[model samples]
Target chain A: MIFAVMVALLVTMVLALVRAFMGPGLYNRILAINTFGTKTVLFVAVAGFLFGRPEFLDIGILYALVNFVATVAVLRLTHLQDPWSGTEGGEAG
Target chain B: MSLLDHDPTGVASAQNRRRKSTVRLLRTAPLPAVFWLLLSGRYEPLTLALGTLSVAAVCWLTWRAGLAHQSLRLAFVLRLPRYFLWLSGQVLVSAYGVARKVWSPRLVLRPVVESTPAADLPELSQVVYANSITLTPGTLSLDVDEDAIKVHSLEQAGVEELRQGRMLSRARRTEARG
Candidate 1:
């Protein structure tokens, strides 16, 4: 069961990567990367449990914090540069 | 020649600020201390001493940066476990919904962007609401401004649910005073 969940998470991560590459605008890329990061955190935690090494959860927690901060930081920096330019990529909505 | 040197009120207010920061530092210290204990899982004297030193350093630095003031109120902290339980349920339901849509053969997306009123919520509550929206699947918080939050939802129903304000009310409740 755990292995199946891991496989599912891996598939989601691949999809997120595809989105990241194909996404039209900077925000789409950022959103995809952020989603990828979240899946990675979940993958790490599940993998830790599968391998019987619970210490991996700490890394998962750290990754989650980093992912959130990185998303916000990138958003802030881009908004400062061109706040209104990304509306053309509204398809990601 | 300096502002503090000439104005007694300025000196008093500066002193008051210092005192308030100290109180906040004391209140925030236990959080890091507990985190260290949980993460280290070590009770030896040397480890305990090091943990104390590190926690103190972290608390002092955060206090200096004026970040300690951002700590949640006791009422909010006490209610967090219940809030998280409810949020996890929402996450599970939405994740399943989004996953179903993703796996369907023909993509059925009715994306909409709408602004929801958030003027009544406190700053912290607004942040909680926005983060919760992002955490749940099918909806993303595009921007949060003084009086509103712009949300992007994969389906019209998601925006309608958000507009109904169940999550907003819960977010506000979490920060409510005892």
Candidate 2:
């Protein structure tokens, strides 16, 4: 059952990935990735607990660490160098 | 050649030294951490202790990849009751709004992104803000920037209300923890 839930959430994230790929801009893609990371963390933890292994919680923690790293990397990629720059005409409705 | 032996001369040839140092660190340093976890009975203590070498190997790689730090030991604990109260209120309000849209003849979806200034909060506070936004029905925090957040809302008014940073009121709660 937990695996089923994880799969369902993964499916939603796949839709999100499409948006990220067709990204109107960098911010959109980063946002999609952030959402994907959060879902992945929950999926790991819930599945771990459901399986009665609880050992998978370690993977959940590691996922969270990696997610934080990924966010920081994305932020650095988008903002650290660009600082004050905003997209000139990329606003999408 | 016995790689474990220490050199009397401090420096080795660069190529072999780099490779040897990398493999050496991968073997020694993580055993203590893996042993601690096994002793603590946190996970499957039995599996962990019995599989000590395997656990150590994984820990070594995890630490090498820089994932194994003693996770932040919260000096101030997570205030579950207060957080729960706030979360439930937000959930109720959001659900009500979503229900209204569902019942209405036309599905009203006015999507907007409000710029939210995100200064004066710690990193965890920012994370909390982003996560909280997702839990709400009418809003999704698309991404967070140093002094700003981009929130997508289901209605113009919701977007406006969020831009006002009422959502950031809880940042103080995380100040101590961070």
Candidate 3:
């Protein structure tokens, strides 16, 4: 049963990765990446249970914290770039 | 505490700064210590002491790393349980909704970027709101500035919900209670 959950999370993560690669906009890519991160946490926790080691939840929490920091960092960088400005230095491109 | 006596060596100010950091360190220590205890699954005194020492050291380092040292307000801390319960409920509901939509034949995604005024809320509450949006399924907080937050929604429903400002009011109430 736990293995089934892990499999579903992995499938969701793959779908999110596909969306990240096919982004119509930068925010779309960021959103996909964030979703992937969340799925990764769930995947790790479920996989831990499937493998008979619940201690992996601690690592899952660590991944969650890292994911949040990464999201904040990416958001700050994107905001600073302001791709809509169209100026060379200001553009995300 | 003689403020009138100005020492040329500036020892008093240094002492004051150290004391402030110490207080911040203490305020933040217990949380990480409890986390460590739970993760380590140990009741041994040596392990507990080591955890305490490490948590204190890390807290002190972060405190000195120039992060704003807002001492945790007791009122805000007390409200965390309620806020988190509400947030988790929202996350679960949206996660289910998004999952169903993703599996449906119709890929009806209507993503949009909308800005909401953030200046009216306290700094911590602003952060809480942003994180809550990001944690939910259909909404992502793309940018947060002094005046507003830019959020991207996966569909019109999420967009309308945010526009209605129920979550914003809930966040404000949390901060207000604190």
Candidate 4:
């Protein structure tokens, strides 16, 4: 069961990567990357359970924190570039 | 005499503020200590001493940064578990929905960027509300302002649900004073 979940998570990460690569806008790419990060965190946790090494949860938690901070930092950088870019939410292709 | 030399009221108020901050620091210490212990799970003398040092440094830095000034009511803290339970349910439901959409043969997305009023919520409550939105799949809090929050949703229904204010009310109830 956990193996199935991990496979699903891997598929989701691949889809996110595809979206990031084919993004029509920066926000879309950022969103995709964030989703990928979330999936990675889940995958790490599930893998820990699968392997019977609960210590992997600590890395999972750290990844979650890093993912959140990285997302916020990237968003802040984009905001600096153009204040109205985030709020408009229009495709930029 | 110069204004800096002998202003009794200034000196007294400064001392009082310092005392209050000290109290706040003391109140803030235990939480980080507990968090460190839970994460580290080691009781060796060296590990324990290092944990204590790190926790103290964090507490003092947060105190210096004025982050400790915003104290949550005990009622709010007590209600957090209930809020988290409800939030987890929402997350699961929405995650399922998003997953179905993702796996569907044809893409079904109605992306929206909408702002919802949040002026009535306290600051901490607003943080909770925004984070809850982000935690749920298909919805992300783009920006939180003094009176409103900008949310991006993969589907119009997600934004509609937020507009209905059920989540907002629940978040507010958590912080409501007894």
Candidate 5:
């Protein structure tokens, strides 16, 4: 069961990467990477159970934190560097 | 070095500073200590002692950096588990949503960037809300401003869900107990 979960996570990650590569713009790539990071967190947690070394869950928690921090950092940097870069113009309703 | 002489300010305020630092240390150390214990997973005296030292060092550094603005309040802490459980359920639901979109034969993405007002939320919850948006599938928080959050969503539904203000209110409620 855990193995199946891991495989599903991997497939999602691959899809995210594909989106990242075929990005329409910078925001798309960032979103893709962020989704990939999230899936990696789940992948790590499930793999820990599948491999019978649940200690990896701790690392999974750390990865989740790192993923959030990195996303915020990258977004902030890009926004500061170019206020209207790849982000869509105007607020969508 | 004397017990409290580490305070460079040579005055009565020095004692107050030392006391405040000690209090901050006590407040901040426990969370990191617990993290260290869980991550290290060894009960030996040597490992425990090392973990304690490392946590103390980290706490001291954070204190010196003036990063200890929030006091440890029990009420807010108690509300965290409920908030986390809710967030986790949201994560799972959205993850499945994204998986379905990803596996669909047609590329049914109608990406939209929307802004949600987040100024009313407590300061800490603003971050929580932003991170939660990013963690959930189909929505990525592109910019977390003081007054609003700019989010990029893979579909229009994701933007609609965020604009509904459910998750933002929940995050604010998480900190309201204190």
Candidate 6:
């Protein structure tokens, strides 16, 4: 079952990868990459279970933090370059 | 203090959210989990130590890299449970749609984008909405606006149905009330 879940997440990752490649705008690419990161977390967790290593949950947790940090980085980068143009205080938190 | 119930009330204070997150993060990170794995007899000698070390290394590197940080509003953090429930149902429904298309005789994909809105909601909620949409099998949040979202769906009708869905409007309301 865990293997099956990993495969499904892989499929999702592939789709997101496709979107990332075919993006119409930078936001589209970032959205796809974000999706990829999330599914990767789920994939890691399930794969860990399948391999009889529940300890691998740490990887999943780490990936979760990485995902959030990546988004914040992108958000900050966008602010630096004024790409998203979606917030206040110019560099508002 | 007991681990389960020690000063539970004190933890609820908004000021503690940061401290709570920091501790919770350290506890749950892969290093500790891998440690648990070894302590509980899951990993062999070399594998156990290596696993924990690698997890720790990544955690340390990522933290120090200091990619960037924009602290989101507390309101968004508080609403995570509700968002998780909303996302589970959305992902399931979208998965079914994707599977049906995969197994069906003729592909009926009619993907389209519909303008929707996350008006009057905390920006964090909007970010969650955008992120969650990408997980659903047949839909992606292509563009978002304070007043609207451009949802790309596998079918135009899916986009239509999404506009009428409870999750979007309720999410909007929740953020608005924040």
Q: lDDT by residue for model 5 over A34-79, one digit each (tens)?
A: 9999999988888888889988988999899999999988988888
The alpha-carbon deviation from the true structure for residue B84 of candidate 5, after best TM-score superposition, in angstroms, is 2.2
Supply the global lDDT for candidate 1. 0.85
DockQ of 5: 0.10
lDDT of 3 by residue, B8-66 (tens): 55788868766765666677777777788778888899987888788877786666643
lDDT of 2 by residue, A1-93 (tens): 777887888897798889889999888988888888888888888887777888787788778989988888779776767532452222110
> Candidate 2 at residue A38, lDDT?
81
- Relative to the true structure, candidate 2 has a C-alpha RMSD (angstroms) of 12.1
Error at B51, model 2, angstroms:
7.0
Residue pairs with backbone overlap in model 4: none
User: Residue-wise lDDT of candidate 2 within B27-94, one digit each (tens)?
Assistant: 55456555556545656767666567665676566545433332333343355457657877988998
> What lDDT does candidate 4 reach at residue A58?
94
Model 6 residue B106 lDDT? 82
Candidate 3 ranges beyond 4 A from true positions: A13-40, A62-93, B1-18
Q: Where does candidate 3 clash, by residue pair?
A: none
Candidate 6 Cα errors over 4 Å, as ranges: A1-43, A63-93, B1-79, B176-178
Q: Please give the distance, in angstroms, between residue B46's alpha carbon in candidate 5 and its true position after superposition.
A: 2.5
Model 1 alpha-carbon drift over 4 Å, by segment: A23-25, A69-93, B1-10
lDDT of 5 at A10: 82
> What digit string (tens of lDDT, one per residue) describes model 4 on residues A52-81?
998999999999999999998898787877
What is the TM-score (0 to 1) of candidate 3? 0.71
Docking class of 5: incorrect
lDDT of 6 by residue, B19-116 (tens): 65455446446545655575556557887787777777655554444311223335755666677887798789779879989999987777787876
The true-versus-predicted C-alpha distance at residue B101 of model 6, in Å, is: 1.0
Mark the regions of model 2 whose C-alpha exceeds 4 Å error after superposition: A1-93, B1-70
TM-score-superior candidate, 5 or 6: 5
| Stretch of 10 with least lDDT, candidate 6 chain B | B1-10
What is candidate 6's TM-score for chain B alone? 0.54
